[model samples]
Target: MSTPGKVSLEDKFGLFTDHWSPKIVGELNGQQVKLAKISGEFVWHAHEHEDELFLVTRGTLLMRFRDGEQRIGVGEFIIVPRGVEHQPVAETGEVWMLLFEPSSTVNTGTAGGERTVTELERL
Candidate 1:
């Protein structure tokens, strides 16, 4: 069942290590579902045009927004509506994430900081 253009999760796991970086695995409905491992604290930023949905599959994720902040563990999910600034944090170590974002959306938007525009590896 090894068909072309299909990548196993294990294969993607072996392709990354950098923190706060997202890798595009595939696309659907004009959105890209990316897999990333994040650690420490990322800048508080947002896409004024696109909303962000994050689902934690293996660890913990903290969503810090201008109004409030919340922590989610495995099996939990959070959505930061458009035009809201937010930051993500992972304490102690790493957090695995599945990001659902528009196909044209970049990792960072108008607030593009140091982590802006990181290269994505093909999985």
Candidate 2:
């Protein structure tokens, strides 16, 4: 069992400096809340069985789809439904965001590569 307490997002974020690597901050109801500081572009991928929720904490995030793109900013969020092909990009600068998804969800989805994180580190 894990200890129960309040988690400061900012404080947790301060513990890491790498980009694209998500650190688990908390879990609830079989889902995980993760944090990542990202920049540049990610691979085009899709979660066949899991939907992903991205909530921006700082900077900007542009979610690209085959149809179009959505620019998310601070305090903004977007959900990419299952089976939808999408990619996340930070063209402006570094972006900090919280990800809410199932514990089984992988960072790279079906497009596994060097950027794929199979095991997540807990903060």
Candidate 1 residues 1-123, lDDT tens each? 886686576578678887777888888889988888898888878787898889887778988888888999988889888888888899757898888898777777767878986566666
Worst 10-residue stretch by lDDT in candidate 2?
1-10
Whose lDDT is greatest here? Answer: 2
Candidate 1 regions off by >4 Å?
1-7
Instruction: Flag regions of model 2 displaced more than 4 Å.
Output: 1-3
| Candidate topping TM-score | 2
The digit string of per-residue lDDT tens for model 2 on 1-123 reads 999889999999999999999999999999999999999999999999999999999999999999999999999999999999999999988999999999999999999999999889999
* Candidate 1 TM-score versus the reference: 0.87
Clashing pairs in 2: none
